[model samples]
Target: MKSWGLLLVAALALSGSYAVDRNNFKTCDQSGFCKRLRGFKPEKSEYSLNLDTVLVHGNVLSAEVDTVDTTAQERKVLWHYAMRLSALVDGTFRVEIDEVDPLYPRYRTQLALDGEPKADGLKLLSNENGKLTLMNSQGHKVVIRATPLKIEFLNKAGDVAVVLNDNAQLVVEPLRVKKERIDDEDGNAVEVVSPLLCLYCFCDWILKCRQVFVFSALTAT
Candidate 1:
C-alpha cells in the first residue's frame, strides 16, 4: 500500500531522530497482499478504469475501480470500488479509495490529517491523455494513472514521492461478510486483504518494538 511510503516520508519529514527497529518489520514479501501484488509481473495490472463512472466536482474527481478474474469460471461476483481524489486549495492533495457499497463496512484509516489543506498553490489540470494531474506551486504533484490503476505522487524535483502501484502492487480489499456456511473459507481467505489492515500491522510492529526496546534498555541500565 502507498501508506508504507507515506509512513517513511512522514517519519523523514516530521522528525528523523527516532531510532527504527527494522527487525520488527516484515520484508514486503511477508505480507500476503504484498506477495500477491509483487507476483503480478511488471506490465500486467489486473485493474482498469470505467470512464463512464467518472465524476468531477470542482477540485475533486472520482471514478469506479475494477479488477479481473476467477477460476472455475461459473461463479460470477464482481468486486465494487470507488476512488476519490481531491486537491485542496492549500497546495495539498488527498486520495480515498473504498468499496462503493460494502456488504460489510470496511476499515477506514483513523490517521488524522492536519486539518483542511490550505487553499493555495493547488491546480487541477487535466492532460491530453485524460489523466488528472494536481500541481502544487511548492513542488508536489499527484498524477492519476488510469490504466492498470497506478497513482503517483511526485516531489517538486519531479522524483516520485509515493506511488500506489509502483510494482503493480495496488491490491484492493473489498468489504466482505463472514459466511456461516461451509466451503466458503477458501474464497474468503483470498478476498479480504485490506490496506488498512496492512497499515495496522506495520504500526503495531513499530510500536511494540519500540516499547520492548525501551523497556530492555531501562532494565539493563
Candidate 2:
C-alpha cells in the first residue's frame, strides 16, 4: 500500500508540473503587428529604396533607406527610416527597423536573442544590381535584394526556409511626444499597461501554483 501511494504521488506531481495552458501564450495571429506583416504581399509594395548608402563595419552594415509610397492614397506619406543590417559573428543576419528620429526609441528586448547560434560561415559573394548574394563556406547561398529590401535564406538544395520582408509590410512608426491632459471629463488619469509587468504577473502565478502542488505532494509523501 505504501509503495502504491508513493507511485501515485510521483505520477500526479509529474503530470501537474507538465500541465500548462498553451492557449495562454500569444501567437503570431494574436499579435496585431505580426498578423499585418505576415499577410503582406510583395506585389502591393509601393515603396522602394536605393542602395547608395551602404556602410560595412566589421560584420555589420548600416544603410540609408528612401521609401516612396506609390499607392495613390498613400503617396503623400513618403518617409525615410534608418536600417541596420548586421551579420552577427555567428553568421545569423540581424535586421532592425526604427524611425529616423523618434521622440523615444522603441523597446527591443535582448532576451529575444538569448543564445548564440552555430557559426554558418557566411561570405559575401557579390553586391550588384541592388542585390547582395552571400555564400556560406559550406556553399549555402543567401540572396538579399534591396529595392523593397527582401531577404531569403536558402539551403544548398535551393530550398527556402525563412524569408524576411519579402512582402514589404515592414512599418515602423516614429514615436511622438504628446502634451495632452491625463484626466478629462471624469477626472481620472488614463491607465497605462506594461508588457514586462504582465509577464512578471503571469510568471508569479505559475510559480505560486507549482509551489502549492509541490507542498501537497510532500504532505502526501
Query: How high is the CA lDDT of each candidate model?
Result: 0.54, 0.53
lDDT of 1 by residue, 30-91 (tens): 76657644555433325556666777666666789776553325533356677766655544
Candidate 1 Cα lDDT to native: 0.54
Question: Clashing pairs in model 1?
Answer: 89-118, 89-119, 89-120, 90-118, 90-119, 90-120
Candidate 2 lDDT at 213 equals: 10
**Which candidate's lDDT is highest?**
1
Query: What TM-score does each of the candidates earn?
Result: 0.51, 0.51
Clash counts for all predictions: 6, 0
lDDT of 2 by residue, 1-221 (tens): 99999999999999997897878889998875566557655445434545677665554456666556555565443566676554443335555655566555455444455675333344577889888877554444567787776767665566665666555654443344333336757988775433321111111122221111111101111
Q: Which regions of candidate 2 are displaced past 4 Å?
A: 1-47, 72-77, 89-91, 111-122, 136-138, 178-221
